[model samples]
Target: MDEEKKGTVHYKGAEGGWGSVRGITETWMREVDRPGALRTLERQNKPGGFMCVSCAWTKPAHPHAFEFCENGAKATLWDLTSRRCTPQVLGRHRVSELKTWRDHDLEQLGRLTHPMRYDAATDSYVACSWQEAFEGIGRELRAIDPGSAVFYTSGRASLETAYLFQLFARLYGHNNLPDSSNMCHETTSVALKKLIGVPVGTSVLSDFHHCDAIFFFGQNTGTNSPRMLHPLKEAVERGVKIVTFNPIRERGLEVFRDPQSPAEMLHLKKPTLISHQYLQVRAGGDIAAITGLIKHILAAEEKLWAEEQRHVLDVDFLEQHTEGFEALKAHVAGVGWDAIEAESGLSRADLEAAAQVYVEAKNTIVMYGMGLTQQVHGFENLAMIVNLLLLKGNIGREGTGCSPVRGHSNVQGQRTVGISEKPELVPLDTLAELFGFDPPRDKGLNTVEACEKILSGEVKAFIGLGGNFVRAVPEREKMEAAWTRLRLTVQIATKLNRSHLINGQVAYLLPCLSRTEVDEQASGPQTVTMEDSLSCIHGSVAHNKPASEHLLSEPAIVAGIAKATLPPNPKVQWDEWVADYGRVRDLIEQTYPDEFAQFNERLFTPGGFYRGNAARDRVWKTESGKAEFTVPDHLSAAGFEDAPGRYRLMTLRSNDQFNTTIYGYSDRLRGIEGTRDVLLMHPDEIAAAGLKEGQVVGLKTDAGDGIHREVGGLTVTPFLLPRGCVASYYPEMNALVPLSHHDQESKTPAAKAVPVRIVT
Candidate 1:
């Protein structure tokens, strides 16, 4: 085959069966190989290795030979690559030269070797000792008006590291701690916190095994969260109904052949995953679908009341614990069925069928993801979901609860350890009392607010503990512009990314140890706690060798910077805690007594522990001390109907990706052979626009305010996506997102709803 033909990305030859083997071979032979690659793979099977560095799903510590997904394997391999990123190697290349490389190529170039600083005079980076880098960063931070510094945390950071980072920021008198979770699950946390007085989900992962029915809304489990597939597969084996609501029909929701199940090996049989019905909801129309279902349930409840039969809702609980029942009923009654049917793209009958499933089931679980959270009214959407579940008495039960599948492994733990920029005053007071230093009381900037402050020249320094902050945010131009104005920028990360390209007046890149790498401190190998999406607190110990000898653990880096930056240290014994992470957990135990009691001893148990909350029994923690129902409004983008050529563009994830991490171009389960260049559209719309499968087209927002994004020569695929809706992978169409566009309550960008049109 021609070189271009072979590298076409979308080309799938006749020998498709050997693709996995070929990819493994190619990645091993040509890409890079580690000294203890098999040892790292073996570590994944052990109890102490951190959660799959890929997704947020938590599993029991089974001693299987291998318990990782293909994408997970890829993440591990990529992290453990043989390539090295040394200061000498970086010295040879200019910043502009490195900018020319693709994001993947830059990361694949290898692991960061040592601390370095950017010298704009020479337009290149130079090696700097860790001590010098810390002092330089500390000088910049201490000199700046305390409010002018912003600190960011990545989801990949362990709970212990995040805790220390937040503590250091507090002592420095700046709370500007924004993180990856701010963009993904902030809405879920906000909505749930308002409705239930808790920020995390209610159920544990094991709860899925006991549920008779599972309702998945606004989630693409296979691509965004492959670990969820394990529970769904187990549910299928036990004959549990799994109904899904999404704009696109994901293949993982159709059928799955469990790699662990033996029955599939001999007969090559795949088990069905979708329930009796799969509803195709329009993008940004989840509220409408959920509202229609709630309406159906209300009617059913009325009929049962007239017949003197017991309904699903706990009438006594509603009367005593809740106060807005009458008002909630009035709101649901006033919502017209015609509007619901039109907006949802599902007829009343379709909703009734799904609602009946929820009503009839004795055990139920409702789960959602960013698709529901990244919207203009994402908070309201989640509030409506809570209302639906509350009607059926689903909250606070064994197998029945609401779950927001958090995007990052330890994001929940980060919050638990007080990583919030807007933390409650109580925690601040307690920390001050414990540390004997007055904590800063001023509220800090969120991710969006921090970027705005930076752009306006109010913020002079940016410190990121982990994560590719630049690539994760939207409106790339504005984000890059803000980053350039910084007086000093410091990033502690395992790999190089575009964020490093947006150089500041003085910039530093500090290499850190990956969670999968065994972190050896003065005390020996250390273990950190990560709270899974299900609210399970577990210990993770690294089993692989360090990527580099110079790299330090995130906690130690925080302590080192704190020592150099702050004066007198407040007598907290910073060096001691840095040397021993267990002391950090000891502080966590003091901070959160209800959950972290005996934190060190509890972590020794397999799968760790579940932080107990009262919500496990349907208790209302809302302002009224009861589950409150917020009315769902009918969403009809008023001018969309009249706009001549406008279409709704929904950002999607490819099968090979997991939020900000692009493993490769292929979406295996979607049958999208091997490329992310294809746009999924309804066939009728494609024909109407005079376009073919492999033609080039331009996509632009309705009224371009200098926000024009074009995906030229994109292959078109016919899918079940609704009319007036076009789907493309995210970060590609992320430019279409406006800087000011986000959920008002949660501050999460509206990546799912963008008005656009295709041009020939």
Candidate 2:
């Protein structure tokens, strides 16, 4: 069969105008039934309704009539689709055959409706009772040593579920609790805690109203979190200078028209310009760009000092509340401009211009995304950003701080509620006092470490709370083979994906209720809580009925498995906690009294409660008892001197997808339609590689670990990218990222910058 006609159209208008409305209409019509779709959307993001499962952007205090964005609508409709993956459907297909399907096609099969066990004889999944499934999982878990089991959590899990997940794992004598945060924001958390004594963004959502300038680095705000455009547009209208640094010229950052505003919808108003200045920094060059800006700021400060004028640097604040300023100053001063321009892909004049905006603004907010965190220098990149903010005393003020834009809905909440591999961070002693068991103290495996352990036959059993572990991790082929070597694997999820098809010696798939479904317990209908990117913990109550009668809440699934796996413990009332989720919240309060005080009562208030940070209150809890500036080693951008044909490839999400979930093939923002197998590159580089537009090509990495790392049949599409830099969609390009390629400190895969060679 001939391939679907691939077309690329350049979009000139603002984002979130008629295009967004049309997208919502088409998604509702195709994925969900008409009247039901409208009803589902009506209850979305309301006070007593389900939360959007797309991005973790904070909800507005006074929401508009329609509170969700286009991607939010897609997530809701995708979850509430009127389709089912029943046992009868599974009987028709074999596991081996289903494994050949694409990731989107597997999820398009529909929501899983029953518990299933792999039957190797027929190479198919057979329906099994919930009790039988739990018992079988418990048996395998008990058969292995406690240290040899890996328990992974997804960001989609609720606070209550994540708390129980950690408790069960620790009580069962294991700390190998790796979650999705290890792949995305682990560096942000680690760096912030060491610098300003907190692991969250310092600014709240309302801070946007008071900022003088907003610096966006490596974040595509329009595509990742479309709802954030509302505040950004308002900020632009107020004359707040928005400086953007991204490798690609994102359409959302250029201009936006709010679909919710009647004036914009009626064509009575023009589109709002978002960025005052857009700097295209090369991939993995964030450190160099930020360093150059700091150098410029320091030079300007010296000039002002020489003229006996007021300087931009907060001298009083730095002396009173910060340390190591002299060392940081000397380090930046020694760096030459030539190195900065070479590594950052920008001239000294551009850096000085951007620095001038920062020097003039009284209060500024610097927000960044995976572009800065998914690199070899990921942790150092975060430290440099903090260093810049501290230089001007921007943090802990009215409208200035550091913000790390998280992708998953509740990823931060998952980590806050004890989903971590480090025992020191999880408060084992406090948990032992509350639950009457000595929690393990040893450091456990992270995402990358878990893969290595599994592959080496060290970890025998794996249980995923709610993520596609095999597909989301690096080294896809090795990960698949490692799964087959495991003694048992269990997936607690809403939809059927590739992870379920790839089986171990004994694999089980347990269907769970989605966030949109009402989770009723013994007491009454329960409400789950999630923490947004701004550290706001809020309640989300589901109003819709369960999609399938067989579905169970994530908390209940954890409880059932824990009860069958461990011996009876009177101190830890697993049954009562599962019966009433309030009991679990009460336990969380007892464990983390400082952060989660009055967890049950406060979570019910309108708009929820803010988990206060010490750094926001101007209190420093670091080793120096004050904010500290640290100089980072300068690392050059990824390039191959040995192989001139090699290009730096960065994996990115299309506009239609969230993380590994592919909603559709069309990325309307980038003007690509009908397919995802395309490499975005510069025209000059395409020609240099002897490749033409629309020509089929292959990508091979230079890891040389005896693993064949290549992806074929990719069409080269010419676009404006930095020389020697290219872009491709993730999970598809995840094959090119080697397991050994990750940050040394955070262990996050450097998906944004991988050296590769293009082959015809």
- Winning model by TM-score: 2
Give lDDT tens digits, candidate 1, residues 1-760: 1132221222222111233334444555644554566667666624666666667776565545666655566677778778888988778889889888766667876889898999998898898899999899888888988888888998878888888888889888878888888888889778888887777778776678788889888887755565567677778778788878887766566555555555653335544444456778888788888878888888888888789887766787677655667777898788888989888888999898999888788778998888788887888888877887777667776788888877777787788788888856239877987888888888898888887787688988888987888877877767787788789899998888878888789899999988788889888898887877877777887887887899988888888888889888546778889778899999988988888888888875666578876677566677877777776554542113426578778888775666666666656655575567677787677788788767767676663565565555567776557767888877667666666667878788777877777867
Question: Each model's TM-score, in the order given?
Answer: 0.93, 0.97
* TM accuracy, model 2: 0.97
Runs off by more than 4 Å, candidate 2: 1-9, 637-643, 704-706
> What tens digits encode model 2's per-residue C-alpha lDDT throughout 637-663?
342232567777889888888888888
For model 1, which pairs clash?
A: 396-616, 396-618
For every candidate, C-alpha RMSD to the true structure in Å: 4.1, 3.0
lDDT of 1 at 667: 69
Q: Residue 725 deviation, candidate 1, in Å?
A: 1.4
Top candidate by lDDT: 2
